[model samples]
Target: MQTSDFLAELSQLTMGFTPVVDPIYGAEVYRFLDLSTSNTIIDSVDTSSAEAIAVYIDTYLSKTGGKVAYGGYLEKRSIYDRSLYFGTQEIQLKRNIHLGIDIWCPSGTAVLAPVKGRVHSFKDNKNHGDYGPCIVLEHTIKGDSFYTLYGHLSRASISELEIGQEFNAGETIAYLGEPEENGDYAPHLHFQIIKDLQQNEGDYPGVSSLGNLSFYKENCPDPDILLKIESKVKG
Candidate 1:
């Protein structure tokens, strides 16, 4: 399907806050975070250290009385500079544009599906700054087929899984992995919507360089359109 058509279909998936992570932290308390290089606060600490970034997020969450810190779709992040897996420091070639919505939470936290889907593939991408223990689910709704990727998952998340397993909306599909196991970048879930896998199995590019930004932005639309976690729930 065309990106426009798929995005249009996604727009009609649902409205209101759809929890993609554990609901223990109600939708109301979820905070949108800024991790891009422009965030001057990032310069205050070490971005290369997973513990440092985790602490930074923890502080932000505590200060805002938020349970979860989310956001990052199409966000240009400088943290990727810490690893060569992304590419050289060259601007045009560097894959610094993040294509997924990262949910900052404690490790081992339950990760849920915002929509019902079946397992497409799963793998443990062990690169230095890559998604570790990832799972991709193929979902078909309204005759439009797409995918949702859950990355940075615990090993157990994919250890006993079958290729064609099915999961329902809001079902616990995986658990967050620790920094050591999750490409050493703090504990969080990298959730993305993929229109086309291009034969990719468990792994997909979560970041993109400026030169290829346009194409990736289309292939990977804003996940918030489906989750709607950015909006506050009305009391």
Candidate 2:
């Protein structure tokens, strides 16, 4: 389907789930990660110390029981030079190369269906800075297949969700995984749009370095089109 048509259908689907309720924790105490400043590459971790990284992950898990939703690694890379990784150097780095939009919220937050579709696949990525519990949905609009990925979710999110199970837009399908279940970081949801997955299932890289900019741009379109309130949500 055309990008416009796909976006329109996605908008309709998301409208049904407006004012997404917090999945793991209640809204009042939890703070939504600011998306405006989010344009910058998130160097939240101390890359120098593996032990420190492990401790950070442990702290997130301890607080939310591994239920944080949108906690994972995000990168910014240059489109022109694939080898030149953005956000790596202290100088000449711009955070414009955001690969995916993230929804940072508390763990255990109930993650609802953004659109009506079937459970395409899921997996437990055990790496320290990866999507610990992730789910992907296959959607068909006008006979063309597209996919949406929800990364860094609670393990329980997919424990009972079976492949091919039909989910209605706005229906509560899973809960936000805590940092332990999610890759260690503040709880949040990594929402991504993939035009072509290249046959990959269960897991896909959400962040691409400057070297793979062209490929990611074509493969993963802008998710903001579907997330109508990008401005409000980010603000």
Candidate 3:
């Protein structure tokens, strides 16, 4: 696609989240990520406060309101997964880093469509530290075709999503996968944008080595460009 066409297409599909509460809790944090990070990928997360994180996830998922937190991409990483776990330099030297944007929310939280698209694939990646249940959608904005991956969702999220099923913009496509089904972490949405899937579906390595950074950089654009959240930094 031409550069101008791509930009125009991007503008069309980019949709904002309909906040579920009167005072959205994380809008400022989402803004911070957008403004502070040029690349749009978040890394170096501290997961030590597991209890606090779990509570946050529960709150979002338990809501009955139609509104949901708006963000571009959802993501998670594992301290047990050697490739992403932070550890001694010796261990980190051999493994890849975390990649993709995480939409931290509660389990059962409804993950809606930012734009119209077709179901690409679904998978039950049942490993303990893997994306337990996942879905991918292929969309054409303007004239360019691209894909978005929704990872770490409840098993039921993918149970009824048939390949090629058409979903309209703002439709509720899937609910947030619970922690048990979502690769054993606190519930959240792992959203990623892919220019080319390279024949992979239902799952993709959001992270890549520093050596292959250029490849991921070009293929995966920052999702927040579409989400439009303002950013603020805190110490």
- Per lDDT, the best of the predicted structures is 1
Model 1, position 155: C-alpha lDDT score: 91
lDDT of 1 by residue, 1-235 (tens): 7667777788788777888888887887888899998898898879899999999999999999988889899888889989989987788988999999999999999999888899999999999989999999999967767899999999999999999899998899999999999999889999999898999999999999999999898889999889887666433
Per-residue CA lDDT of model 3 for 4-59, tens digit only, reads 56655675565453222222344443322221223332233333343544654344
lDDT tens digits, residue span 1-235, model 2 = 6666666765665542143335343322232232222334325545334345345545644665532322122344232122222245333333334566666555777777666779888888876657778888888877888888888788888788789988887777777777666866446677787877778777877776556667777677766556544444344
Descending-TM-score candidate ranking: 1, 3, 2
Better of 1 and 3 by TM-score: 1
Local accuracy by lDDT, each model = 0.90, 0.60, 0.60
The local lDDT score (0 to 100) that residue 61 gets in candidate 2 is 45
Instruction: List the candidates ranked by lDDT, beginning with the highest.
Output: 1, 2, 3
Instruction: Please report the TM-score between candidate 1 and the true structure.
Output: 0.96
